[model samples]
Target chain A: MSEILYRILIQGGSYKVIFNGLLATLRISCFSLIIGTILGALICMLRMSRVKVFKFISSVYILILRGSPVLMLLMLMYYGIFARSSLEAETIAVITFSLNVAAHIAELLRASIDATDYGQVEAARTLGFSAWQAFRLVTLPQVIRIAKPVYQSTTINLIQWTSVVGYVSITDLTRVINNIASRTMQPMITIIIGMLIYLGLAYIIHGIFALSDYLQTRREEAA
Target chain B: MKKFLLVLAILLVTSSAFADDYVGFLSRLKTTPDEFFMMMKNSWSTGGWVILGGDHSSSKARFYDTLTQMQLALNSGEIDEMILPDFVADYLLKINYNYSRCCISSSGKMGLCFGFMKENAALRDKWNEALSSMLNDYSLIGLAYKYVKNIPEDESYDEIYGINRKQLNKEKRIKFEHFKDAPTVKVAVTGDLPPVDFIGEDGLPAGYSVAVLAEIGRRLHVNISIINVNAGARTAALVSGRADIVFWYEINKSLSVQPDVPDEVILSMPYLNWDKFFHVTLSDTE
Candidate 1:
């Protein structure tokens, strides 16, 4: 175990590169998550709207984004769409990943909103609450509670998908690990380290979500 | 149990008819498609695949991400035959002690030369003039021998491939000369090509090509900057101005396959050349 640890930490000063890669992965994942969630909320609102045109627009957007593979989307964004542009690969990765995540989040949010009891909105209206007021106070809070679990999962998936950013020339965790493994000719140990890093990141995200859920439940109990 | 053992023995004997014979090829999925890939593809379809195994199946052609993977596959029985440079095979067989190879053909003429943009004709001429001097002196052959000394010592070249090694003075020397005005040249090479260009222990590019280029730079009064790139990015490196020269083997075949490579890029005279491909295989013990 010590020898393995020594090799992992000491060989070729590769740990530094792997750490830098982890940071790049996190940066892309976080920025994409924020952008995706905001865009997803807007998409969810449009999808929930009574207007036929808005509903149609949201449906087409979801259909296209969800249909394509993330790898294909990333390639198109980097090599085809931005082939002539001066945009850096990391910027392109964020844009592509954000668009990808927004489609799934839109569906998740739409389902959560739909699953809310319609009678609650009716009750709010009987108490002289406006449609906007009813949605803001009664429906939105319940939607958050119902959607949080799925939203957490979607965020974790977004983080993992950032590994393929290497296709566009961004040195994310997985790509760097593969490069090191190729150079050292030790795929077994290098792969384990990569997996451990990803597992650690995933656990942190899970912990934060769990903590949020625990706090929310406590606040409800207090109420 | 006796009946099962008898059935197993029969099955093993029957499976021997389809003995594991895999020919490894570098795919564009990982590396760039060069003349080596094209030649292998053509040869496989024509008859080379049958020579190694019985028939070409979808499973017979194994794809490798890097030459190192191909080397490992050659050891692990994942692949039986691999298309590799003559020198690389010699070095591996010398060290591994469990691998053997047979010469396929030394008749294929391919030039390993430096490439430049069409507008850079003056630079190309200067480099070509320098290369000719080295080729005449046999110093380049000396350098190749320094890195790899395994020359085909048998009379098989003429008998099988109709090429006479002795008549051609297969060895050449490259002289090192200082230039009064050395221009800085950025050269691109795929670092995954072992014994030619590969990442060394210190995480920097090191190999036979690295040594050869360093010597060329010294002689030409040119400062050489090597940009290590993937096979896929080699052409792009030249087109995007990231590299001024590309040290590629067989420019005609490598560039012909890549449509994006512009007509403006020109190939220099052959400095390094390989005449044949060898059939690399594992010994029974391995």
Candidate 2:
């Protein structure tokens, strides 16, 4: 299978296209993960607020994002929102995916915050801690611990979902494979290469997640 | 009443005279020049008369001989209506010319004859009329037979000789000949060759294999059709009697060691030569 893929990639300038596409995909996924996580934390705080209007708005936001498919959302943002505009497709993909991931991440973060031991927050409050200070000291740390596994998986999933950027003509890994197959007239060879590359990238992501999990466990054991 | 009767007789005589002229023209041109030239003349005369009256053919033919004469004729402004067959009119009018002529031989094979003219509206209209008339007169079945019977089998030996000899002995050759006429000996090819084989435009088939097999069908007098199939299903296409030939396959050395092909199939000689290349670009730093 690798041999077939190797032949196709080498023939049609597909290898370079795939390499560049993979790099772009990684860049977008990583950027979105960071941005979405920060945004998610902020949204979670808004959700936890005492204000009724704030909670309702946050609920509506999450409902809209979670209710729609990523593909439909991407298209809406790209064409519907930016009609007759001259924004690049890659920019649209990044914006759309980051916003989409933020919605789910916000829900996960809110759950983790709610599940935290209420006694810890009360103890901090009893010791004359302000609301912000208590959140910084006790609540935030515990939420991170509970949410880390979910966050890690979301990042991995974001990486996979980035493959759909090819639909907007961003020349992602899948697009490169399609182009090669068309030029060489060999679908079997190009598709096999695309699958191997995807698997390899997934393995790298899993390794990084495993390392982070191990480090977190060690820190807990030390404490 | 007498004048009315005379007018009717005159109309009948004129109609018969025109028919006689057409028949005389066909007889004169049939034995003289190439078939294409004769067909062109016939098409021009018939199409011109049908569309516009007057001696357009003689004037058009004369105009073709000299550019100055054509210009003079244009400037003179004596001609009322310019008559042209579809193709020629299309060129004159600067319209998009998208017509293609496929020569199908008697054996049910197809071959491309000519194509790809730029926009020429006047010429296109003229050519269209001529083509329609020509199509009505010439039978596709007759053309297919003529194309196949003239295939120069002796010249094709260099391409197929070695493979055919290796695949079949004298007895097998005789058997193959018998099988060629077998009612069930249907040939099918996958209509999937990237850009060339399966083009997106007009949905018309264009490719080296399509061209070659169309000729073969004409030669064999068999009907041919293309089916789109994936790589894995290619062999199955043959075995299931859906296709008599698989057009695309790589020459892999591993086939000798771990042969995956079934025994019922026979591979044909390689018809195409391909070159492999690795393209490299210098780094930005350099």
Candidate 3:
């Protein structure tokens, strides 16, 4: 126990770096999540549009962003796209990760929409419901429910992927852990703690989804 | 139980793919594209990473993304011998018993210097002046002896090499002074190279570069902030204006060690020349 403590907390007072790194990770993840969601909704709308041009553009965007490696995308964004621009590495990382997440989330939303029962929307229209009302009443709920679990998975994945931010000069959680490991020469212990912390973050997101599911069930039961 | 296991598998696979690189798919995510291509070309070898001799000659040498991977490959018997910087090899020999180290060759070494923007000639000259003073007075070599040449032979009381060995103190970090109204220079330190440009466990930059920068800051009365960057993005930091100066390792054209100033970014005078590279292999008996 003391050995673990020394490795994580005492040895070189590494916990400070750990905490700062965690905060950087959280900040980047949060920024990526928010911006990615908004951008994803736009792509989803574009993919579902009646205009062929919009559909083609959305298809290409998804194809490129989804197909390319995130690490490569990040480096290109930093060293190529925004190379001359006076943007910080972390901001460039957020932009890159957000684009990648937006692609995946767009696909996720489209799949959830496809999974929703069109029959219910048709039935709602027959029962004198407007298009918006039918979507709000029948289609949206099912889409949200269907997207929940996968959304949780995607969020967890994004959080984990943020570890690569260190590659771009950001001293994130993973880098801090690496710093500690390098400083202390206790790779096993330091990595175990890092994994546990990441696991804890993943579980927290998992728990949030689980709670939403339970609340959703209660609401359905009450209705 | 099934869900727990599924998540665990995902953790191992994904984290290894993109994060927690110490134990990952050995060659997949870490290395530069060039190094990765090298690994692919030599796909038969279970382990491959590059280690340039101190003499700046690398042929048939493998490349690694991080030092930790080198250690992993060496221990797993994937590689015959691991080549490393002389200071680091000596430090590792003291702590690790099974390891035996030898200098590979010592000739035609490159100069390590501070890189700055093309327009920032004034800032470049300030650093050059400070470096020249250090070189003339031999204070730079003295700092290297304090940090690099003086690794403790005892394997006991081992933690990280962040603590200065001679003083046996972690608290007294050589830090840059930030004056009340002085111009602040954001210098990037990778902390990848230990005992030289390394960060201590105290979360402070303390090593040869830090000591030299500290003295320069004191002499010039300029505020200097040492920012830690990954070794890969030193140039990115400089070009993006995120850092005013960065440590650059250059193989120059001159006979003796001289600053190889590139056209786009000027380089300060060379502070250290790594004339010796050490190759360490596991002792058979151990």
- Top-lDDT structure, candidate number: 3
**Candidate 1 clash pair list:** B137-B173, B138-B172, B138-B173, B139-B172, B139-B173, B139-B174, B140-B173, B140-B174, B182-B221
Q: How much lDDT does each candidate structure score?
A: 0.69, 0.49, 0.72
Taking the tens digit of each residue's C-alpha lDDT, what string does model 2 give over A1-223?
4444444655334456668768878877888888888887778778888999989988898999988888778756654675345676677788888888989999999899889988998999999999799989898888887987888788778888887665443556665555454433344445667788888887888898789879988998999
Kindly list the per-residue Cα lDDT of model 3 for residues B1-286, writing each as its tens digit.
9999999999989865653212111122234434433333243232322334332223234555455556666666555466565666676676556677633533334457788998999988988898888888988888878777766654245556454453565424675667898888888887766666666776677777788888888878888877777766666778767678987454332232222333577777778776554777767723
Q: Which residues of candidate 1, in runs, are more than 4 Å off?
A: A1-9, B1-20, B28-59, B68-77, B86-191, B195-272, B275-286
**How displaced is residue A98 in candidate 1, in Å?**
1.4
Top DockQ model: 3
Model 1, residue B131: what's the lDDT?
75
How many residue pairs collide in each prediction?
A: 9, 44, 5
Candidate that scores best on TM-score? 3
Residues B23-79, model 2: lDDT tens digits: 111011112323322333344333311212223233222212111122223333322
Name the better of 1 and 3 by DockQ: 3
Judging by lDDT, tell me the better candidate of 1 and 3.
3
Q: Give the winner by lDDT: 2 or 3.
A: 3
Q: Candidate 2, residue B231: CA error in Å?
A: 21
- Runs of candidate 2 with Cα error greater than 4 angstroms are A1-3, A220-223, B1-193, B196-286
Q: Please give the lDDT score at residue A82 for candidate 2.
A: 56
**Cα miss at B160, model 2 (Å)?**
12
